[model samples]
Target: MPERQDPFATLFDMQAEAMREMFGRFAGTVNDPAEADLGQWTEAAEQLRTMWLDFVQERMAGGGDPANPLDPAHWMQMAQGWARSAPFDPAAAQRMMADGMELWQNLAGAMLNTGGESAGEDDREKPALPRQDRRFSDPAWREHPAYLLLHQTYLMLADHFTRAAKEIDGVPEEQKGQLTLATQAMLDAMSPDNFIATNPAVLKRTVETSGQNLVKGMQHLIADLQRGQLTHTDAEAFTLGENLAATPGKVVHETPLYQLIQYNPATPDVLAVPLVIFPPWINRFYILDLTPAKSFIKWAVDQGLSVFVVSWKSADASTKDVVWDDYIRAQIDAIDHVRARLDVPAVHSIGYCVAGTTLAATLAILARRGEADKVASATFFTAQVDFEKAGELRSFIDGTQLEMIGKLSPDGYLDGRYMAATFNALRGKDLIWNYVVNNYLLGEDYPAFDLLHWNGDVTNLPAKWHGDYLRDLYRDNKLVVPDALEADGTPIDLARIETPAFVQAGRDDHIAPAESVWRTTRHFRGDTTFVLAGSGHIAGVVNPPAANKYQYWTGDSAAPSLEAFVEGAREHPGSWWPHWFEWLQQRDDARVPAKGKRKPGGRGDKVIEDAPGRYVKMR
Candidate 1:
């Protein structure tokens, strides 16, 4: 029997066959076959064959090295050897291919005399077509075909090496029983079950935290396949609970809030005390009201504060024209409507992430018109009023890139898909490469988790709003500086507002750097309290009662700024939820009868629902 060919070798053969077919098609396009230059055609064909043969030989030689086959110890040696012998070196293969293709086209044009005479003047005067845009254009590899070839080749070699390393490390070696036991102990500690029970949210986060590694491994085996899979899986897996509890025993609101209007007879009564929630459009609002034990909303309600959350609807193409002004106006209107219905005093507002910017804009707009009395207090959660030190993501959103993105979504709407991809890319080694190995190569099914599902539940931004935000906040650092922005031609100044304030910062947050959050404290003139919490962006904010493992530090003095507080404050080992609730309660007004008590309109009787709200349910 003939020797079985390697799967990759078969791919190479297919590529060669496709190239031959392309050549045949090019040859057939000649109008006058009799006038063709056989000499040039023959020479070009021979060169193509030689190039392919060299590529095959190099592949065989690299794989045949028995000493280094799938060995991590030999990674450096294998990389060096492969790099030295790369057959597809930049200048060698690409230049030759370009030159040969040009020569071949010229010969065809010469043979096809049908339009040559008529087009001679036009051809001479026409500027050379701009070089076709290439996929990879790093100048370092401009003249290095071998570098490109080896870059691709090493990906495959690396995957094999990684898998082999894992296998070797997992097995017991001679006279190493203790080492094996220690390794097993570590693996047990990191096992998904332990993480799942201790941190239910870890199921989804493990995938995100490890997504980069998965993508890298998958990219070598299947281009763009891993991204597609992740996108689909994430989009599909997102789910929000269908029930809500306004009070412990009075009423159990079990309707999908997204589909219902705020039409409680008590709407007028509850509206008296405005509860403004700033929910980032990036995900659903339930992160705050996650569960009864950990639900910020429940805690607020229990404290006799009338609470209202900004329930952001799923954005699609129709939301393209909704700019920053529209969102600010909607929020302001919602507050005003509540005020009208309740016949009560000004509202207290809480803003988070992107919502913080929106709230800042609203406050500025209100302050410009001398409507500051409407807002009683403002709380910011990992929100940055100043974007100058906005974290690692700042490096990516300079003017040029933002402009390009603006053009793509001119209405200022940012595509959620693009945003997801960018965040994934930032930590490609873990988020991407790991999944490629487990999901695609190893064919593992995605594990389940609510928080990850929420993280993946992305929403789009209006092109106009996205552009304005990037320009004003990120690129211009407008919100942090007085007179840095204007809404509807009215200037915004954060310092002029006298609303009491509370701000929280996460030490490990990559989205909003702690410094930026600290700088925002300077922008507030009200009685301000800033706290530092342990955890990343999402975890720090969504921390539930179950997460007793984490700790938060608090202080009374606003001197030395946020950075000083972070450095000096002692860790009070416990969930930060209780502390935050206490701070908020101090600012909350004492309970009176809801100004205009509204009767419930036929929902469920009093009952406790599962954690996560209706908006978070998977579609």
Candidate 2:
């Protein structure tokens, strides 16, 4: 074929020239060694050779071909193939990267000090080690003179190959028959006047003129490497099932009691007030019961308090009829059952996330009928009682979207995947783009972090409950105002709740923003303490004593207003775990042994084995 004056080819040639110039500049900056120091140079050269050989062999065997520039489609196909074949080998990748980083550090140190003649002999013999290899491998390392020319040459050819492959892939199957005719017609259609008139052609011309292929390539590669390293690192650093494993704590009468409970010594003997933990039904309760160091449950149990945690049941199609009211009823039933067995007059209740909202509603319903004696105190964690400022999720609950989802299920529940996708879209840079680049392009595995794994373990919401929740709370912000929401035909009034209250809000929470949690303080008429924790929703509530990096701000204002606490909070940097422990201790009533003779056949018969509660382990 005759030589084609391809614009893309010309651009590629220019990029090659620029790359050579940049490499030469970097090489010139390196200090030159004396002839007598050839031995040291030889050793460094041999190390470099070994590294390069290993990289080449690895790439040839399975990794991306260094001789091939990455085409999006080819890269995706190759990555998917690799993932299917080998999955994510996090351990192996971590080890390889670690070794590579050490080698690179040693090589750089040798060059930088040049035997440390300017410093003492001790310094020359033992150099301070580099920082732990936090960053991924820099592609720029290949710019050394020895590999520069060959690497560039390989990349150029690969680019051409990738471009050709992409063109072939983009062609419609039906149009393949008239390829030559279409090409000539395209040439006829692309006359300079037509190109100037046509927006598509004009846009094409602008891209060609920018001459940004190499910059784009480098950007793409950097993104790929970063994603790969993160995936590999996360996978190696975390384990989904393993991290969620329950650690054994003190057992009360053959039942596992989380270690966070405490009881006050100065209270009536008849009142056996236990802390009722209402963890979100979306995941297991063990996020609060993680490990002794991070375990809120464990900490509480150790405080000499009686603790009762709700173990949620998993739902299948059989449980489709279960509604929001059913959950509230179940919780109240648990309370009655616990009271009957323990002969407790009242219990302090702590609710987290969605469960917090449910418990708040339950309290309101009970209070409206003057039945407030059932509960002693109420606490919420990153929970929203006022949905007026429901944060980013507000945009998603428009009439049209609600109606569309309502049509899918007559009752109004949206699919769990839909919710997951929406949450994922919110942080597309970190969730979507990062995963795409890592798993699809870099052939890396997903991490096994406990929280992230829990996040991935999605559960379906009942259509009716979801629809009612979004429309009433999010769309209209009805929950906070008077007579806004009705439970089983009874209106919910927050002013009726007279129990002592504790509310915790995280500063960086995007899910239930701090403002939403803070608003709950306005409704409570009794003693209240508002705490500002120093992490996101999950991390803040799951704040174990071991996570000492956290800080908290608490205010003296028992004011009936959220704004008053905002003014009172002075910034204090340290773990909030100790403060919460102390605060809960003050509120806890004195514990009493089970008043009546122990009932032989109580709720314990139905209790499942001590694993993560069913809802959490489902996925």
Residues 1-619 of candidate 2: C-alpha lDDT, one tens digit per residue: 3333332234345345534544334334442312234454455446545655665576667766321212234233322332232223355456545554444344433433352223234334543333211111233322222222222233333333333322443344322212322232222223221221112222222233221322333334454343332222243454423454354321122212121211112212323567778887665566776544776765665554566667564444445566667766766766666666466677788889888988888888888877788888888888888887667566456565567556545433344544555565455445545454344333334555566655654555666677777788777877778777677667888888888788899988888898888888877777778888888888877776665677888886565555677677787766676776567667664555532222122344333333343344453
Model 1 root-mean-square deviation: 22.1
Question: What are the clash counts of all predictions, listed in order?
Answer: 47, 17
TM-score of structure candidate 2: 0.59
Per-residue CA lDDT of candidate 1, range 49-95, in tens?
56556645865876633321122233233223322322223434454
Off by over 4 Å in 2: 1-245, 248-271, 407-414, 558-564, 592-608, 613-615
**Model 1, runs deviating above 4 Å:** 1-239, 243-274, 291-294, 302-304, 410-412, 593-619
- Local distance difference test, per candidate? 0.53, 0.54
Error of 2 at 61 (Å): 31
Model 1, position 296, has a per-residue lDDT of 66
Cα deviation in Å at residue 165, candidate 2? 38
Worst 10 residues of 2 by lDDT: 255-264
